[model samples]
Target chain A: MTTTSARAAAADVVIRTAGLIKDYRSARRGRTTGHVRALDGLDLEVRRGEVFGFLGPNGAGKSTTIRILLDQLRPTAGYAEVLGATPAAGGPAVRARIGYLPGELAMQGRETAGDLLEHLVRLRGGRGSGRIGPLAERFGLDLTKPIRSLSKGNKQKVGVIQAFLHAPELLILDEPTSGLDPLLQQEFLAMVREATADGATVFMSSHVLSEVEIIAERVAIVREGRIVDLDDVATLRHHAGQQVALRFADPIRADEFAEIPGVEDVEVTDHTVRCLLRGEPDALLKAAAAHHVVRWVAEDRELEDLFLDFYRVPAGELHAEAEEVVVHGR
Target chain B: MAVDTAARTPTPAPADRNGARADGTRLPVARWVLREQRRSLTLWAISLAAITAMYLAFYPSMATDEMEAVMAGLPEALMSGMGWDRIATGSGYLESTIYGLLAPALLLVFGIAAGARLLAGHEEDGSLELEGTAPVSRRQLLLERFAALTFGLFVLCAALGVATLVLAPALGMEVTSGNILAATLGLWLFVLAMATVSFAVGAATGRRALALGVGAGLAVFAYMADTIGEMMAGGDWLSTISPFGWYLGGDPLTQGVDGAGYALLAGLVVVALLAGLLRFERRDLGV
Candidate 1:
């Protein structure tokens, strides 16, 4: 289903990083102490107009990576480029085409939201006034209230507005929906959709899968500064296996169900049989029909298990497992 | 304080957002920096006016012979040590106390506080992320912010100049407007030196306490080097390098423009700002 237009669009890499490394040096009493590696040879390629999700737990170098792309933090070693220009060498001209939302936003002033936005718009030297009204109205943001008086959600809305104000070619948002309520999260998602429709690329990072799973075409799960898992949402859905339990009218051979394709971890106690069903369940279901079916129950397997497979393993072992997953995924 | 951003457009932006074609766009970052500081600047200006008026208004009373004898009766070493040499004459009284001592000292505190807060405080509080990622370059951000700091300090120092000119005649201080300008200009430049020092430290370190400590510490050391060091044998050279020495030692009140004072003090301000910019750009921010 890849149209020529889609193929052409997918060829452009909006952001690229290779062998990127960032190490933070700690100090005690002015003495040099050991350092923590925030990023270890991380690589990424985000296609144009794609909603790429950067997933990681806290202290996983998610923020560190975003900051490096924005040239806010220089990498200890390696390279990063945005829109064909090295982020550090891109200068302001390159950044002018980018919009960023910091994860830990700090807006302190007596200025009202309107005042802050106006100042921000002026700072970018853009005609952002056009986007301000609709974005604010859509988010149900009160523009006249002083920024300090606004609630956390309201402050986050302001951050959202400023990020989209200029309609930059690329948007780098770090936990953009942190304080939004569920309903507002929907509105934020819709806004992101419209932004992408207009040919803008979105690179959003989140620790949770709910939002990212909905919008992202591809996602990279980072752990301890390296990408442990990466896959497409479509592939992710296919991997969403379910745990199935069936109670037969009489005792039957549970070993038979275990032998079937796409069924795993079968266990039986007298009349009931339990197993995991991955992909199509037709074969497993048909096999169960031969026996009396008294009751059947199934629950979707937790996605956390997929992440646990990566997160719990030691780094050296995870590398081989991660490569295997990637190889089998495609 | 909003300079038409047009007038201050930074060194022709290498290129506009669209391409290599540069445009004559205004400098909004500089204006934003100034706007952010307006409230603090207002408070500092108000305090400066009140203190300057209160101290200058009492100059007439302190100019009396009785007050002069009282100042003299105090230990000569203590009086001379604090630079309170001539209270009988209006010029001497103004120079030794208000113009020379209190105004510069208070201005130093204001400058250092603002300097520390300018970059380092915002960086620590995590507020610098907004401007840091804005389409503006670090050079523009640094210079524009420093411009705001420079503008804020300059305005307060200029107020001291104007207030003294207005009060000198009413208080019967035997000093011309030109003399007040000369003396206040020295103080103003001296304050700029210290403010830039603090600002440079903050920009380079991204630590408010370090910036504040280093700035305030330098002010104390410079004050000592200029005032107390003179008493020590072979210590006369200390004032030559100290900003306080550049202002007070030259006695700009009596000696019209201290060309050397203006040059050296202004040189220090420029050097600090450029050095800060170079360091700030080279180092990792938000550390």
Candidate 2:
């Protein structure tokens, strides 16, 4: 049954999930067992050789989806396929082809970072320590120091190195830069780009919009256990409105600013006019030129707020859009 | 230093080079688990052996007629209840005092602690999540941990046996080498069964408190059953159900090996291990 589906899916679609649902049931104590829906009919796809961003707030099911992809957690309903095979059924065969960095990575014992990475490399069936030496150098990690003695950021560097050392076909990183400094985060981003250049697929989840904006070509914004928006990074940025606060030499009416193109939610107080401007600002600039402008300030709307706007949309409408995308193979 | 992007991104290696054998066999996780356990296993073996030797060293002085008289003066029922009925003979004295009592107690503590650390400890610390991401199945992880536990128990028992054997002749204790080996084997099997129960419970539930509670509770119940069963006639059947009963019932120190008793302990280990493996495979990890 899986073979037929695997053959049907283009090899380019490295990750595909159809109505994947994950519900975690609290232990049954008496008759009242609580069920937390971590993933609610989530349908997602990541094409081959691309860095796809998974953006969501905490408890928004980003980690749950990653766990299902890694076969760490089984979905309650629906189908999930990674690299042309069901993760649970493929087991180690599928896992062998993927490099994963968990959100909360913990290392035990007094083993040095070198020792831990060496063991992981061996477990991945890679030969020699040659790969690790280069990764350690790239991350500026001290392999000689014990893991327990390393700071959280250094430990995170170790996690990043191990994930890339195997050079697997797919990389599933959950909050990959949680403890990393900005400089190291950029280095990690470069590493991701390099991996994708070598024909690897990256599915990275993060709440940091700027980071995603910098590297991700496409992103899926998850909210309340569902993917609220999935679109090209450029298109999403184009939809983001700008905050235009204009202070005029003469008193301006709110309706005058509202008459301008691409302007919405206008507020006028005496000589000050503030409004949201979407799309091109050429028309609004010309309209402001008609009035004597004392001070003009236009700030780009935060991507975080744009994400929240998508979440604010009604679930049924978002679900319909998601379904349309799925049906049309967008 | 300038970062080398070209060097960092090497040509992708073949899929097979990552860890797969020609026959599709992989033992990396198992080997890794064993490596992690090495230091702790060594410390446990050495500590157990040293404690066993210390107990053995006191045997020579306690072997006198005066000690025998004191042992004889105790009530027969009391001596039997405490497992000290044969305190006069060197073999009986060592069996009743050390192997029968102290050894099993210490090993039980070791087994329970090690078993909890292997599964629940790793889960709680979140390391198990990273392991799960590798090309290793949950069943493989559980089995490898169980294997490490088994190996550690074997080493600890072997150390105790060697210590007793070396100290027996020098201390004038007339225990046979066969008896020492049998006693060590019996203790190892018994404690291993208990530890397997702990491992199985922890793997199934992922709750360290529950696992420790059940494992320690069963051991205490079994010990008390054996002790109480010896004092009362009607309760003899109770000892039959306890692991301690199986070990003491075999009388390994004096009677050499008890095939039936060893089989019971082995059977318990197998059943508990299977339960753990099944539960671990089915449940979500790092919860």
Candidate 3:
């Protein structure tokens, strides 16, 4: 089935964080300093057997949501439920059923990858050999080297393997592909697909919506600690599509094109007219052909334009932040 | 050929056990603790062996006539500090004074250090989160670590007992191997008590240095209280407040496991363990 049908078909809710808010006081000042509102009154849900993409701007509470859901960080207010139990109220029972890759992966320096894998499996109540070796092989992880000696990307590969080794019912990953290259990112997506194929729910948090666009059935866009948009991937795209510019064969007045369906902000400049279109292109084409029989160029709408329109931020300012998002998605 | 077809995947049945997804057994708790303690095992073995070997090497040399005469000529203050006041005078006294008091002190420090490392040190190194999210209760985790430390202490005590048993005959000492075994086991129980106390401190304050500092400071204070209570004569009741005093008064080297002292030490250990569990249950794991 398609993702939309799959979402409608499955009634299971694997994870939900309701009215979650987290506040962190500044470390340097003793007084309740640096009240970092990491998560702010956010509610989220991930249905079973689908990849849910959690997207947000920098410091926009994507990680905060994941952390609180995993019971790694306590919420200043509100509560979270993972796998049908309150996370803050002893979520270990729920945590055991889920696989989590932290946004920041720091492991024991002296331990080799093999040793860490062996130890983590035993800790998570599974046999060490059940999935470690195969997952490592798939990810091209060198399990022989000490963790301290491994590169950042190598360590991230180990983190990925460990999280997926147990084959959890719910996989909660925070920037799980942070250090992976393009090929590995695809492989990781394939792994997620396989897990979802086995009736698992994958909650992938990343700043780049494009990374999510490939695998996510649904995308939740978070901004400044609140979810600004929550919808299926196709709907979000439809709602945020950029305008289509249409040029006429002859000198047409800007006002003439304005009356055409789905055309907005028409400007006629020396036999060329630029306009934004939301719906079908046939109407604009018909309108242009009636004016004259000549050549025209209809510039394709960029996805970035749609992104800016929906986010309400200027394109140039978001470019730097988008680079960081790409870095996070790796 | 044109084809219009689809594959329908069957839906899985709902999980039979509604409240169960992961195993709720406590076995993982023990496994996690044992795996974490692998590094500490080698260090603990070497250190405890060194402390025992240091005593074994030096004790036999003091068994000679000239050395015995020198010990007999030692000042009362030195003897008092060295725990020479309670037991009979002999090479056994020297052995007991060394192993009975100092060895337990060293073991207490070592065992308690290991206990302190279980939480506070793991938290400091950022690996606490690995096990913190495991399907284990905080109390279960704490008890598992204490069990590992207690197991390690038992190994240390057994090794010490065997070493003393083999060496006692060569030294021409008349002490029974049974007495030495009992004394060693008793000393281990006392150190276990100290370890339980340290575990409580570690869980209560999620800071390694602070836990160790507080544990060591508490030991020193107990030693002082025991010393002052003993010297003052009328204030012997004050010794009840310190676990060190309770175990130290047993004089296992010569007296060989007095019932009251054994009871006191056992009570102290049980109380400490229960307090540690309660504290662990109430506190958050990675705080």
Q: Stretches of candidate 3 above 4 Å error? A: A1-10, A23-37, A57-59, A73-76, A88-93, A109-111, A123-128, A238-330, B1-29, B32-40, B64-75, B84-97, B100-102, B231-238, B258-284
TM-score of chain B, candidates 1 onward in order = 0.87, 0.90, 0.78
- Answer with 2 or 3, whichever has the higher TM-score: 2
* DockQ-sorted candidate list, best first: 2, 1, 3
- Weakest 10 consecutive residues of candidate 1 chain B by summed lDDT: B1-10
Q: Candidate 2 clashing pairs?
A: A124-B18, A125-B18, A125-B19
Model 2: DockQ against the native? 0.51
Docking class of 1: acceptable
Better model by lDDT, 2 or 3?
Answer: 2
Deviation in angstroms for B153 in model 1?
A: 0.8
Interface RMSD of 1: 10.3
In model 2 chain B, which range of ten residues has the least summed lDDT?
A: B17-26
- Tens-digit lDDT string for candidate 3 (A1-330): 358855764457777777888876655633545677777788787777889989876688887777677665667887677777777574567777777887777777566898877767766654333466667777788889988898888888987887777667788898988899998898888778777877888999886767887899988777777665667777666544345554445566777688886676677777777777655678788777677645555554543455445467543455464443334322
Q: Give the alpha carbon lDDT tens digit for every residue of A1-330 in model 2.
A: 157644654556999998999998866753447888899989898888888999988889999999988887888999999998888888988988888899888886788999888777666655324677877887889999988999999999998888887677899999999999999998898888888888888999998888888889889999878888777787676566788899999888777778886787899999998988877889888988989999989888878777776667677787775554344432
The segments of candidate 2 whose C-alpha lies over 4 angstroms from its true place after superposition are A1-11, A27-32, A255-262, A280-299, A310-330, B1-26
Worst ten-residue run, lDDT, model 1 chain A? A1-10
Clashing residue pairs found in predicted model 3 = A26-A33
Better of 2 and 3 by DockQ: 2
TM-score of predicted model 2? Answer: 0.91
